[model samples]
Structures are given as structure tokens and as C-alpha cells.
Target: MAGSELTNIKSPRVKAARRLAKRAFRDRDRSFLAEGPQAVREALALEGVVAELFTTAEAELRHADILFAATHAGVPVFRVSGEVMSELAQTVTPQGLLAVCRFLHVPLEQAVTAGSRLVAVLAHVRDPGNAGTVLRSADAAGADSVVFTDASVDPYNGKCVRASAGSLFHLPVTVGTPAAQAVARLKESGLRVLAADGAGERTLDDVDLSGPTAWIFGNEAWGLPPELLRLADEVVKVPIYGRAESLNLATAAAVCLYASARSQRAGSESGPAPRLP
Candidate 1:
């Protein structure tokens, strides 16, 4: 532990960390709270990302290795009471461990480069959980970057960060860029921009996914608008064979990104597989 247990909920340090629960305060400080052991571990893996760590005595003992790592890295660790932990945490159930981490988003140009093969763009997506799930899916699908457009939810939102399950620190993320500008940059980098919408001329199975691709997913309630759809090289949808109404934003994004990943890997070893009619 770096200092004595922080028992005072109204202490200056405790209050500053608690303020990160709000988006405005997070933006002002360029910092956000990463709750739970998993989120804390992930944030610590990256240099300088974790500024401070808060843990209860039980959590420190339960997750001794994590505390050791934080101390080894010179990250200040504060032992707080369970009550103080609750005050600093955003979740209904505090994990007894939390980390104050700096924002990790990079510039749009840096995120999508010439050699980039796979990318996910969230346009006008509002739900933090949905956006985080999409980001985690993109990371699993070997995407080079995930872009949260200007109108999309902040990637650093606590719920979104938790939903990402530590994948947020695994890949480059571009935030606050306009959807059109992001699409243009991806195209300029030679990526085929595909907009995923329920109503589209082509289905996922019909598109050629072997090449470098960028998938643009829209808001959960209403999908991509006409102007956003027009920006894509192709507008595609996930075909529903069963009687389900439709896939949610996160599910749809995973399907699209994985399809491209599979195709690209296959193309490298053998060749692009025949598209189903």
C-alpha cells in the first residue's frame, strides 16, 4: 500500500476519484474509473494508464498479485473502507478494487492506417454496453482499431469500459471523430467501408470479405441514416434464416467483423471462398 487506508469518503482524493463517475468530470480530467480486478489488471498492463489504485483490505488480500504489480510499477495504491469503495465505484456491486486510468483513445489517422485490415466504426451508437460489446467483439475478430464517432457514446463511460472486459486496452480506439471523416480516412487507407443495416441491397454472406474492411454500425433503435449509408462502398445486412426479428447492434457487429476476419485469414492461406448465393 502506498499510504494509509483512505477511510474518509469526503477526503480530497476520494472526492476527485468519485467525480469520475460523471462524464463531464471524466472529460475534464481525461480520466475514468475502471472497476473490478479484471479492468484494473488490464489498465495496469499498459504503461502510465493507471494513475492510482483503490482497494479494500479484502480485495488486496484476494488479489495480492495485482496489488504487488501496482506497487512494483510505482502506482499509488490506497486501501479504502468498503463504504469508501462503494462511494468510488459506479456499479451496483463494487468489486472492492478500482483504478483511475487515463483516456486511451488515439487519433483517427493513427488508428486506421495503410496496413490496417479490419476496423469497427460505431456511428450514432448511444448505449454504452452495446458499444463496449462491439469493441470487445472487434478485438476478438483481430480488428486493428475501433472508432466511436462524435455522436457515439464515450468509450470511457464506466459501463462501456466494464462491458469491454479489458479489451479496451488491447487495441487502438479512435473517439469523437465524425462518422464521415472516419469513413473517408478508412477508404483512403484502402479499406472497403461497409455499412451494416437491416435493410440493405446485399447480405453478409454475399459480400467479399477477404480484403481489408471497415464496418460501420449505427444506433440500436434506428440504424444508419441515408447519408451514412451512402458513404459506404456497400450496405449489407445479416440474413435471418430463423424466425427472429433481428440481431442487436453488438451481435450484428460481431457477425460482420468475424466474417471479414475469417475470409481474410482464409484468403491468406488458400483463397477467398465462394460467396453463398
Candidate 2:
């Protein structure tokens, strides 16, 4: 299977890969596709993360290193055609490589307790790109984990996975948790839950983010509901000094998470307890 080209788009394996484009199929199979060399390479780096690897003939020659790594990891490497790769990939420009990966999400309790310093809870974020960007930002900020509430976009969606830029595999993530339940669990674990919204009474700069915290982000259009905001310990807003209307959800998340990260780092180095937010 490594050297042979799978040209037929209707091949059973090809069809199965294509079915991953649907949420129902991904849920049923508990598998998702990681396309492109970067995503595939990251998947292969983890033990048993990649179920299989698909490479086009031309791509196999160009990206032989990736294929070799996959094979070395004992993953089944199959050669596919350009047309077949395009059919299986979701991007406008196919990367000629793809991987079937097992579900990466962890249980809510497990993720909540993964490390407890900083967590990002997305309550009702509907956009897959935004959700993925937030996850990537969380990873960059050294957050402990990311929890996606039931109303949030599927983090395993192709667009979301691509937007994560391989961060999806780098952190502990819990999906399908209810917003209220997520907040309660984080609080029970002694983390301060700060709801990020435009109508918040307290500004982000006014809050002490050095303590363990869970930052909750809401939907793009409507933002967090009043009821949801009330569930949090406090509602915090990112101050806007410029003429720009509002920062997008991902940008806001990056700013808030990094602020917390900086505070935590500074506190640890100085041997002083971080102020509670």
C-alpha cells in the first residue's frame, strides 16, 4: 500500500476519508483528518496519534521525509493520487498529504484537572476558525487546558483543525461540556472564572490574573448571555483605546491569556504569591 497509487476517488478507503468532512461521520467514527505536511508531521510525532497517512505519488517524492517518519512510527502509509488527495483534503490548495487521527479530546474532569493554572472555556463560540484560533492562542500562552462547551463549534472540524496549526495536538482539550458545569468545576478546583464580554463592569487591566483562572469566551455575534455571565465569578472587559469597533474573539483571547501568563510568570520568578483576580 505504500508505493501503490490509489487513483479511484470512489475507493472505499477514499470514501471513508471523505466522510470525515461530515460531523456525524467524525463523531460516529471518532476520527478526524489532519491534512498537510505540518499537521501530519505533528500527528506522527505523538505515539499512536496518527491512524494512517495518505500521500500522493508526487508528494511522496517531495515529502519523502514525512512518509518515512510515518512508516517508521509503524503507521500505515498509503500512496494516493493528486485527484484523490484533493478530494479528501478540505483546503483550496491541497497539500498532497493527510492523516486519520483518533479523537484528541479528553474528558471534562480530566481536562479541567490537567494542570489548573490557566484554562480557556469557550461557551458558545460558533465559528470553527475562531474556536481553533483561540485554542492555538491558549497553547501559545501556556494555558493548562481548553474546554469547549456543548454549543461551541466542533474543534475537530477540518477548518478548526487547520486553524489550530497543530496546537490541537499540543494541549489537553475537553469538548461538549456545558458552560455552567465548566465554570463550576473550575471554581471547585479554586480557579477564578472571569467571563470576557464587552459589557463587563470590570476592565481586564483592573483584574489580578496571576492566580489560577479560567477565561470564558462567548459567541461572536451575541456574546455571552447575561445568565452565562452571571455564572462567572466576575465579568471582565478588554479596554479599547482605539477607534476600532471591537477585537475579534481570537484576538481578545490572546490578549487576555497572555496577560495572565505574564502575571503568573512574573509571580513565580519573584517568589511572591500572585494577587487574586
Candidate 3:
């Protein structure tokens, strides 16, 4: 890492790995791309989660500290060309560095709700940007978990990953079949399921989010599925004064989640939180 000479990375192994990364094969192979010097640096902080690092001359010079940290962590570091870096990067601009890291699947059982859990359940949310924004808000509001179910966009998808601004690596997020089961299990485990519905009569203010609650935000066009609606202990709406018709799904989610955060914080300031139903 302290060497003055530039490292050349033109090995067949790097090529094959970059090729595999283009397909879902890398993901299927239990790895993902953490591109950009900033992203690579953020991901490297995860240590064991980040298995390897790739860089070009620009990254080595511009992001030397990042490269140094990855090398120091004993992660496999390879030097490649800017062209190859572009090939491996999901985005248009290559930040000169990328990382191949093992994907740590968050089991439904381990998803932040071990106890005193406040979670967000995003159901069939189609927009990766919306989904990612929900994650950013959840991170900011200190929610225990953010779960997506029913063919929602992959949170690990490049757009979602970037939209999360690296928060995807910050929290417990579960995707896949276990997600559906996770919802039912949370309900049975005394976690209140509150679905966000503009049509619903109950306002978010009416619900006490101070306790264990899973705030469910559905897709933009279709909204919550009938079954999920039936599963909710209650459906809450964010009060709208303007004639704007409706808020974006992610905005609504931030409103709902932060409302809960605000209520929880206020409750903490006062006496004990009232028993939430």
C-alpha cells in the first residue's frame, strides 16, 4: 500500500470475476459490486463483509487511503484499467475503484427485531428510488429494520444501492419468501402492523408508534394488496391539506416513520410510554 510504483491489474482472474459480475451470477455466486471509491471505502468499513478490492491508477492515487485500508484488512486487492473499472461498475462514471464482497443474507430471524423493534414493511413497492428512500428514512429514524416483500425491486440493485447512499450496508434488510412469513410472524409476536393507506380513515397521529410496530408502505400505483390490508391491525393515512392528490410512496413512508420517531422521542422525554394497542 505504501509503494510508490503503480500496480498493474490485467490478470485473467480479474477479467473473469468482472465478467461474472455483469450477470446476476456474481450475486448468485454470493457476491456483489461495491463500486466507486466512496462506495468501496464505505463497504470496506464492513471488514469481513468485503472480500476483495479492485482499483485503477486513478483510484490508487485519488483514493489511496481507501485502497490502503482494503489492503490492510487483507482483502484481495487488484489493479485494473479505467475501461475495466467501467465494465464492472453499474453506473456510467467509474470512480476508479470497485470491491467484490460476499453478500451477507439477513435471515428473517436476525432482522433487527429481536426485541423492542420498530420496523418498516415495504410491500410490492416497485420504484427502486422510492424503496431506497424508504431505507434512507428508516436509517435516519432509527427503525430496527426495512423489509420488502412480494416481488419488490431488489434493494441490492445498483439504483437502490446508490439511492440508499450506502445505508443499505447500515441496517438489517430481508428480501425473498421469508419476508412474507416474517410479516405474519411479526404480527403473532405482538408487533402491531400498520399499513399506510391514503384511503384509510385513521391518521398516523391516531396510532401510538412508541411500541413495537411495523409500518407497511405499499406500491405507488396499486397500493397494498387486499391480504396485507386484512393483516394490518390498522390502516393509517398521512394528513394532506393540498389538492396535490397524493404524496409519493417514499415521501409518505418518511412521514409515517418519522411521525413514529417523533412520537417515540416525545414519549421518552415525558413519563413512560403509554401502552400502545
C-alpha RMSD for every candidate:
1.5, 3.0, 4.0
Residues 74-122, candidate 2: write the lDDT tens digits: 9998888888988999998998999999998988788887359999998
**For model 1, how does the per-residue alpha-carbon lDDT over 1-277 read when each residue is reduced to its tens digit?**
9567888999999999999989999999999999999989999999999999999999988999999999999999999999999899988999899999999899998999999999999999999999999999999999999999999999999999999999999999988999999999999999999999988877888777888999999999999999999989999999898998889889999999999999998885544445655
- lDDT for each candidate structure: 0.92, 0.89, 0.74
Better model by lDDT, 2 or 3? 2
Error of 1 at 49 (Å): 0.5
The list of candidate 1 runs beyond 4 A from truth reads 268-277
Segments of candidate 3 deviating more than 4 angstroms? 1-23, 112-114, 268-277
Model 3 residue 255 distance off true place after TM-score fit, in angstroms:
1.0
Model 3 residue 70 CA deviation in Å = 0.4
Q: Candidate 1: minimum summed lDDT over ten consecutive residues — where?
A: 268-277
Indicate the residue-level lDDT of 94 in model 3: 74
Total backbone collisions for each predicted model: 0, 0, 1
lDDT of 1: 0.92
**Number of the candidate with higher TM-score, 2 or 3:** 2
lDDT of 3: 0.74
